[model samples]
Target: MHADILLRGGDIVDGTGAPRRRGDVAITDDRITATGDLSDWTAGRDIDCTGRIVAPGFIDPHVHHDEIVLTDPGMDCMLSQGVTTIINGNCGFSIAPLTATGPLPQPLGMILSNDAPRFATYAAYRDRLRADPPAVNTACLIGHGTLRINEVANLDRPADRDEIAVMARALDAALSEGGIGLSTGPFYPPARASTTGELTEMARVAQAHGKLYVTHMRDEGDRVIEALDETFQIGRDACCGVHVSHHKCAGLANHGLSETTLAMIDRAMQTQDVGLDTTPWTASSTMLNSGRHRQASRVIVADSTPHPEMAGRDLADIAAGWGTDIDTAMERLLPATGIFFIMDEGDVRRILAYEHTIICSDGIARGSHPHPRVWGTFPRVLGHYVRDAGVFDLETAIRRMTSMPADRFGLRDRGRIAEGTYADAVIFDAATIREANDYAHPTRPAEGIDLVFVNGRESWRSGVHSGARAGVVL
Candidate 1:
């Protein structure tokens, strides 16, 4: 007869690929206890939502906040953006669920050092969350490269049978201890040397335990098709599903390749297993020392600190400005600045419209012109592609960011707005919502979010955060 919180007169999308309808939702404790007309329900707190699209809170399937949230739990960047649940451990670069201790991954260098030492294994990371937490709920996958190289320290060649056995043992340990799946980056430094057979061995281990295989495919430029084929082979051999993390083709040769590439996935999904995640923007951002940037035709200096002159210049422009060769300029910025504005807009539209694709933010909190996607990913999808570009219907677009990812990762109780589910929801004006971020000035807050709730408690509303930590790490 009584509810913990009630949202009245909101348009509900539910994230189930269903049509939107006007209704009310009532929460008891942290679960949605009732839906449909509840105008008569008694409640401890009630919020009027007369003009808003109330949908399941966006669940970011791929994220890179391993260190940011540990230090800055505010998550105002994401919270303000309406993200409730974020899945980290993407691209084999998580600080945690490491099977052993050694040099931390390349990404750990940018986030923070204190967080690095704590990530020896999945259990160690989970133990940390049990004690201290972040503002948004996070489910971490085991970074494959972390487990393999952290223990062995180096595996440029295929692992021996015995070495493979050791890594598999450590991987199984992490998965059983609550790792969501296996994340690997064939495009990162430590992961670059990993051979297919070694990855297949780990994939089998994940498949055995019902975990996923998410990969930064071996190559996305000249060898993209080959890399994708290799991924499909691994899934087929391991008998598990595979996800392509931040699927994109970089460099001039790679522009406009998404249609062909997604066609490959569409054909593969008919029988074999494969999927992808992409941001709703043309430019993908990343650390300078990353494999993709190192091999890119040119790693533009989007923004740089300690060198303001080069902040907004591209690689060619930076090279010209500094009176140095492009490679020399790239070498200089690779140490501190991250780059953006590198992918094809045509490809981005093609991938977002793919039926098998989900959306994700492979973001860095510290980048100087970080692709606005970091702050505007989910909101941009709702405002631009769905409402403006007419790429997908409201129901379908939200599903890619919500239920599609939740179901892919086997998260059972959260994505959809349903009775007995955790009431993580968002209320925003569909007509007014839009991303204010751009490559020139990337930190602008999005417009039009009226409210955000995690676990049935208000987190943000009407341009002000409600100062609550309703998030509980999973």
Candidate 2:
């Protein structure tokens, strides 16, 4: 049979955590038409994938590409790492369901800059995505903080009953309009006042719609255990699946706490639906004003509007140069982003090695000096973790980056290599695939990702983008 593209003689991981097998994959249009022995299948385009690993394209389950997906649709940072799909609207902040058009509050403004366009409804945002598609497919969650921004007038206190009801209605409508779930970040200032009852009400709306409750828990430091309890309680109360975003133990005092936290998650998953994701790096990034710097051993100013020249400089150095304390320097860099080295290396390794853990970038696609995770996540796992450090096997790593997240997020057809699945695949030399970027050079593309296909179109090849905008809002 004639196929649109023929990928010949490669070791197919298939993204099911199964053993790799030498086979061929045939694509016609946007779906995998056939796999296995397709010697007789001819195609309009044939590529030799011999000696390379042909696996399902990576899916970043957590990211902040809400506005960049519209502004910089090429998404080179993601595409270069073999990521074909990304889940957006994480950490209780999204670009849509927004009406207030002035400056965004802290944390939200950290990711979505002050000038980001506002969409009054989730449907409007989704419509814009469809009209001007990005290079990668996206599944979004409705942000709890965004709901507060829309419905609640007071930011320093918990939402009133009427406010909660209005937020619930908005969340329900967003979920019905294609939101994958509800994401909360009580850790952020805007949602800090949200009580467990308020979160439960919002989660119930998502639950009614059969969606998940994803969270950047209220705390990931000393109070992380309490935060986990709160997350589980809300999940149980709402009867919904729970996803922990960027599961980590911040602060030196909390080092080695993943043993306790992962155990808690394991115990909860026995009676509840629970999943979590983590980045491969030990450092975390967010707004400079997040107060995470108190726990950080070092901080780098990722971006600062007031001091544009300070990007990529250490916060301490900036403070010293300005003849002021770190806090004062930080205050002057309002509406800025910082990368904090607050997490322990051991904790990062432990979380990434967790059996239920899905790999994600949690990348903010902005700033002059963005976190290396944006361009390095998938490859770092594949090369550094899988090959160098032996954190997991190649097949297992592929599974975490592909099918595990796809199944969790309900993107069933896009993360597998079996027949009838969407043709999203990456071909790379397994031995050489590794991230090229680091904290110093954060935007460099990854090495050894020879070719990438999204929806049967060659979106990236040989370190160059094909300019194929075949992505859709999933």
Candidate 3:
């Protein structure tokens, strides 16, 4: 008889790749109560959505918000982009299931802050999140690197049989405590020495619990075909779904190789369930690794340990200033992060245009000069790719950001605008929506996202947070 909020007069894109229709949405508490012609519906508040498009709140499937969610519950960067839910613990860099005894390893320490709270067990971490949730809902995967750091002390050798068994036990316990799946970044130093047998064995633990197996793959450049084969073999050997993180072909030598890699994914999907997520940008950013920087045409220092003032400078310039090679400069900057311009524009577009491709920010919520994708990913897709370039229709684009990711991660009730579903939605002026963030100004919020609702509560509206921390851990 009564609605908590009424969104009246808008084209509803239900996020099912369905055609938009003029309708109104009625929300009662945290669930959508009704849709279509709610002119007579009485509600506590009315949000005029005239001449705007209302769709399900976006889902980011690849993000590293594991520690920030605890440190900054507001999560304003993601909320401002209409991202209601985020899948954290990506790229084998989760912040939990480790004892607080030893030093944090590479890449993991880079993503998390120095003083992040440590949890001895995965269940303890999930319990803490449930008690004090962040502004956006979060789902997590247990990173293989997390297991390695906790179980195996050496980085130069593969885990022995006993170590593998111990890792498997930890993974099974994490899944039992509500981890969605397992993720590995074999390209990173922490997990580079992990053998295929070690990964397959742990993936089987996830598969037995009906969870996912996602990877950043072993390589993305010269040996990409071999990496693709290894990824597919892991999925088949473990008997579970496989997801590729930030799918792309890197380096000038591999400029247009996404065509080949994507085809390989399609062929692999015919035999096993496979999907991927990508940031809609031509540049990729990550921890400072010599191998990555060697292939990149331009490498910008995002954050540095030894030289704190070198955040926004180019790596080459820093080397020239020091009268040494770029590699030597990088060594002086010992623990650092960088934005590498290596991906091809054509490859980025083709991947985003793929039907099975899910949109993910893969955004890092750390550093002074963080990648622009952290703030601009979702809007960039809607504005630059969909609205400007006509890469895909609006409805299709919405599906990629919303239902595609929700379905991939098993968030069954949060991706569509219909009765009996969670009222997580975004209202925006489709014509005016665009990303304002760039590499130099990475923290700027997007424009034209008028309001964002998480679980029927107005989380963000008109460039300000409403101070409502109503999000939950899923």
TM-score winner among the candidates?
2
The local lDDT score (0 to 100) that residue 250 gets in candidate 3 is: 89
**In terms of lDDT, which candidate is strongest?**
2
lDDT of 1 by residue, 177-214 (tens): 88889988877666777788889999999998888999
Please say which candidate is ahead in TM-score: 1 or 2: 2
Q: Model 2, range 327-359, lDDT digits (tens) per residue?
A: 999999877899999988889999989899999
lDDT of 1 at 376: 88
Candidate 3 has its poorest 10 consecutive residues by lDDT at 94-103
Clash count (model 2, backbone only): 0
Q: Rank the candidates by lDDT, best first.
A: 2, 3, 1
TM-score list, all predictions: 0.94, 0.99, 0.99
Model 3 residue runs over 4 Å out of place are: none
lDDT of 1: 0.79
**What is candidate 3's local distance difference test score?**
0.90
Any residue pairs clashing in model 3, and if so which?
none
